[model samples]
Target: MPTVLVIDDEDMVRLVLRQFLERQSMTVVEAEDGEEGLRLLRANAVDLVICDLIMPRADGIGTIMNIRRLMPAMKIIAISGGGRSHAMELLKVAEQMGADHVLGKPFTRDQLLAVVARCLPGHPMTVRSSARSG
Candidate 1:
């Protein structure tokens, strides 16, 4: 199974993502902030990253930039719940900074799975779902 790193400050959000991804048979690792997320990424091999935008201790943009600089091949999905306006802005920034995909918060489990599928092609687990109900 491919490894995925999830970075979010909120415990509930992290739990939701971890549970959903694990259900897809992906190995899940977590960090409360971008700093710890980056540290884990450097120390271990992570196939995908799902990061939140407003986290303390480095923020999602910084994490994405740094990760792109150090490991451009690493796939990243930037996620934000900072309302629709803020989330759109963050999504644009994430794209500019090299994130593979950007998702708004309150996303469905299937939406998350779809973005992962688009970003990580070779991993069969990432290919398992779509944003729309099947």
Candidate 2:
């Protein structure tokens, strides 16, 4: 199983994603904000990172840019939901920053799983389903 590092400020969002991803048997590490997320990335190995674009500290774009600079091999998935236009803008920024995927908020579990699959093509859980997990 490939490990996934999920970064978001919302406790509910993290709890939900933790439950959903764990159900697929993937190991998950969590960070409340991009600063902590970056710290975790630096200290531990992770196959993919799913992060929120808007946060109090070290927003997604900055984190993505920094992470790419520090660890070019790291795969990133940028997500935003509170604002659609902002999310789109951040998605573009994330792309420019070398993120592998960008997802909007209120997405289905399946959508997240699909993005994760794209990030880690050989992971077993990634290839197991095509339907919406939510």
Candidate 3:
């Protein structure tokens, strides 16, 4: 199964993402911030990184740069709902920073899955259910 690292400061965000990814039969590792995410990345063979652009300890841009430096081919999907009216700008920067894809916050599970499929085309992310309740 494809392994995904989800880095977000909010507990609810991480929980929801874990639920969404798990339902798709993907393994997920959670991190509160980018620093923790990097540490997990080093220890685990993660296939994807779904990171929040705005976080407390170490932000998404720095984390993306580091991942690019460490693993040039690592797949990254940067998410930002900065909710500060600058979320789009941050997402744009994430794209320029080498993130394979970017998603604004409050995205649906289907949208997230589509991006993941695009990023890791070789991996199979079969959903357990066709319901879009999420």
Candidate 4:
């Protein structure tokens, strides 16, 4: 199974993402911030990273840059519910910085699954029944 690292400051966001990704048959790892995410990346062989743009310690852009430098082959999906009006701008910057995909907040489970499948083509798409109702 492909392992995905989820980086976000919000507990609920991480929990929701973990549940959803796990349902798709992917291994999930959680990190509270970009710094922790980077640490986990170094410690584990992560196939992809789903990162929040606005975060404490280290932001998504910086983390994405570092990840690109460290693992250019690794796929990244940048996500953010923008605090400011420039949330889309930041996501665009993330893409420029090396995020393979970008997702805005309030995205549906289907959207998440689609992006993951696109990024990790080798992984099979496995959707549980609960995920469809949620």
Candidate 5:
């Protein structure tokens, strides 16, 4: 199974994402911030990273840049629920910095699944009913 690293500061976001990704038959690993995320990346062989922007330590942009330098082939999905109006702008910068895909907050299960599928084509596409539950 493909392992996915989910880096977010919010507990609920991490729980929700973990449930969804696990339902898709992927192994889910989580970190509370970019700093922890980077540590996890160095320790584990992850297939993809779902990172939240605007985090407390080492924000997503820095994480992306470092990931690009360290693991150029790793796939990244940058996510942000911006504090102000610049969420899109930050996401754009993340893409430019090397995130393979970007997701805005409040995204649906289908959207997340679609992006995951696109990023890791060899992974199975089965969607469990639990993934659609609240």
Candidate 6:
């Protein structure tokens, strides 16, 4: 099973992602902040990282850069709900910085799964859900 590390400050977000990703047979690891996420990344073998851009202590940009430096081929999916324009800009930066995909907050499960499927094409486990979150 593919392992995914989800880094978000909100407990609800982590819980939701864990439930959904686990249903897809992925090993879900949770981290509350970018710092914690980095620590978890070091200790665990993560295939993908779904990170929030506006996080405290080592933010997404820094974390993305660090991951690129450490694990250049690692797949990353950055997310943000900062604002309409601002979030888009941040997501753009994330893509430029090496994030394989990006998603805005309130994204539906299908959207998330599509990006994930594309990220791990050869992976055996695929998310098969149509649940929406908004």
Question: Compared with the true structure, what per-residue lDDT tens digits does model 5 show for residues 8-115?
Answer: 999999999999889888999999988899899999989999998888867989988998899989999999874557888888889899998888887888878878
Give all TM-scores, in the order shown: 0.90, 0.89, 0.90, 0.91, 0.91, 0.89
Q: Number of clashing residue pairs in every model? A: 0, 0, 0, 0, 0, 0
What is candidate 5's local distance difference test score?
0.86
Model 3 worst lDDT window (10 residues): 125-134
Error of 4 at 61 (Å): 0.5
Root-mean-square deviation of each candidate, in angstroms?
2.9, 3.1, 3.7, 4.0, 4.1, 3.3
Candidate 2 has a TM-score of 0.89
User: Which segments of model 5 are wrong by more than 4 Å?
Assistant: 127-134
Per-residue lDDT of 1-134 in model 3, one digit per residue for the tens?
88999999999999999998888788999999989999999999999999898998799999999998999999899998846688888888888888888888777777788788777788777533332211
Q: Please list the C-alpha lDDT of all candidates, in the order they appear.
A: 0.84, 0.82, 0.86, 0.86, 0.86, 0.84
Give one digit per residue, the lDDT tens place, for model 2 in 1-134: 87889999988888988987898888899999989998998788798898888888678888888888988998888888675565677677778777878887887888888877777888756444453321
**Candidate 1 backbone clash number:** 0
Which residue pairs collide, candidate 2?
none
Pairs in clash, predicted candidate 3:
none
